[model samples]
Target: MFVSRLLAMCFLCVLAAGGTVAWKQRNVTIDDKHGDEVTGIAPKYLPSHAWSSGPRDGLNAKPNASLAYNGTWHDSTHWVNNDQIIVNFGFTGVSVYVYCIIANTPPGPFFDAFANYHILLDGVFVGEYRHDVEMIPDYFYNVPVYVNTTMQNEFHNLSLVANSTERAVLLLFDYATYTVVEEDPVVASTSTDTAAPTSCSLLPTTDQPTGNSQTQIEVIVQVGAALGILAFFVLVGAVIFHLNKKSRTPVLPGTTLRHISRVPRHLATFYRKIVRSLTSHPGESGGVVGDKSSVAQVRSQNKD
Candidate 1:
């Protein structure tokens, strides 16, 4: 039974590996379009704002707007194709403004609708906008739009397309500015076994004063040393107290008597015999008679 289970597990692992390989081999395709011309795309009478060749032609196309007149124009029949603007530089997002100068006309039909316009990036359709503007006669209109795209590649192609036939002369293209957006890198924080310092202040992040601050390891070592020193002093005090108490206590009377009894028997006997002889023979020989005579003579002299 165990062998069979092991074989089944191995087969499942092989199937999973094959599935992963197949998924990696799959490819995705993106659809794109190009622009070809910018002829009189801007009216001859209006001032030139900004213009670039469409994708249909290479870099050989000329700037369509004439900078001669400071005035700009916008009409229902005029339109400009920006399909040829190359965005070889890398970017994550962009903002474009199409400035229009219109004559006396109240909110006349113009390129204010975003649905009629869209932006492309790297041959991929990215975004579209529809804005509205009601202009008074002889006033200028500034139309701005924004598009966001991914920066998957270094070089990219961008184009603006007008879905409506409405014409509007572009005075200036405020320059295309790009912002680089990147995902913050993932950093997996790991814990270490090393001891970190403990802060004494309410705020843990605040720096400690230079003197007398304790690190974690130092605190532990100091506490251990203090306990050891206290224990040593306590032991020393106990020994001294024991010696003092022993010295103050008197020796037992019974123990002193026992020690005296253990003295040499001959020396004790000899001391007793000498004491007896002195008491028995008080005044005994010729020296005793001579002493008595001298005593009598001294008494007679004192009387006289």
Candidate 2:
């Protein structure tokens, strides 16, 4: 029973180790697609009256109305400096890798003042995107070009601050797109059959191990430890079985067991001495007190 309990404890330890490793090894990512046009996440950030003067420029302005527009929350604007356009992603931040897309106004940059804009994420200044209209020709104003910026960390919300470098240089703002990036460990089973599942779930899997270095090392270590524990348990169980069998076997009589079989050791010795004395002298048993002397004499006369 002791050996069985020890083996069971060892097995539990192995299981706990496996669970710990699995918990530490887990890693996953999730990305969300929330565009202003689709889920209306933008309305919560930008308000209605805080847009630059257009034919009818307001927050949530549609395309084709005016290429010369702006995006984000807050109504604060200024002609001299400090024109902030903020887009809030709320408290629950999304994954990393932010991609923003903006289109220039249809009227072209050569006609209007260019925009020198600074990008910020969660209040930290990132980089700048310059739409210097004077350098660009009128033909290319309608065409959309790519301007990209990357951050070392992900954030909940982002902001684009625009201040006029020149007189009346109002930057036309377009809708921004939000997306998340994620990656997780991909496990492949050795059974490359069409029916096999691609995931490493609890379903039946092949005996062949994974090809990844980390996974292979973990598997080897776990198997080795488990086998070692099992081997130890088997050895202990065999020894215990032999010891128990030897302990239960009966002893032969006439040895030390005979003297000490039932009674106490001292009492057994006294009883043995008494039996030896009584059986050795047979005459003492009949006339020890001489009370039958008369009977003995009568028997002798009859005989004569």
Candidate 3:
């Protein structure tokens, strides 16, 4: 029983240690974003762009193709289409800007610049920006936009369109990207279906109570064994004492002789009485004295 208990305790200790280790190792982290536009982007980095068209040729100028450039001056406005751009990076937030620019001196007929614009994502129209009255050099209108789409599998379309009869120019595209990371789910170290030893349940649920119980049982068993041994020794000692007492009890030499002597005294008295009673009888004879002498001799020999 003691050996079995020792093994069970060791097993339980090992299980507890293993569980602790497993729990410590059970954690998750979001690695990175998962789309296309994040080509040169670091784990959490965002991309930016800015561009412009010349004043004289703005009417025929094309929108800037570079991802980093926004737009500038022009006779006719051009649109920058980010609709095909998808940020593969794992991010939850997106910020976009639409800038309208007008210069002070124009080559000939530069109409007062004014325009309306709209933002789109995944073919769904989200928001719109309208600027009707505008004029002057480096005069620029900025529209700040924000969107929250926590998770995405592919590139999301982002775009801005200009609706203007007068010539309009875009000077900047300020983009700020943000990511919202979700907390990893928690995991248990051990399965609920795992079987534990029965002894684990037998262990004291409380330290003090268990300790007291163990102490009490140990004390009781120790006391009982001690008492049992003591009793056994006491019985053995008593037997030995009796044997010693019996052996040591005084024994007189010639005890039979002493008893015989007392018997002779009693017999002599009896013989004397018999003789006196016989002497008082007139019919007593010498043969009776001879018969009495023979009986006395036989009694004395039997007593010896």
**How many Å off is the CA of 283 in candidate 3?**
95
Model 1: per-residue Cα lDDT at residue 84 = 25
Model 2 C-alpha lDDT per residue in residues 1-304, reported as the tens digit of each score: 4356446656755554443222111212111123344334542323324454332454332234323223221222325554444434422223233222223342433334445566666677766766554443232222222223343324455555655546433444433443434443333344567334433322223565324534656778999999999999999999999999999986643454465557876466544444444343446643333345534644565556
Model 1 C-alpha RMSD to native: 19.8
Tell me, what's the RMSD of every candidate?
A: 19.8, 17.5, 18.9
Candidate models: Cα lDDT each: 0.38, 0.43, 0.43
**For model 2, the run of ten residues with the poorest summed lDDT:** 23-32
How much is 65 displaced in model 1, in angstroms? 12
lDDT of 1 by residue, 1-304 (tens): 4356446656755554343222111111111112111211221211123333222243221133242122222222224443222222222233222232222332224433112445666677777654433443333223345444335434445555443445442222222333333343322223355433221232223355323233544777999999999999999999999999999997754555455557687444443333333333336532343255545644565456
Clashes of each: 16, 1, 15
Q: After best superposition, candidate 1 residue 246: deviation in angstroms?
A: 3.3
- Measured by C-alpha RMSD in angstroms, how accurate is candidate 3? 18.9
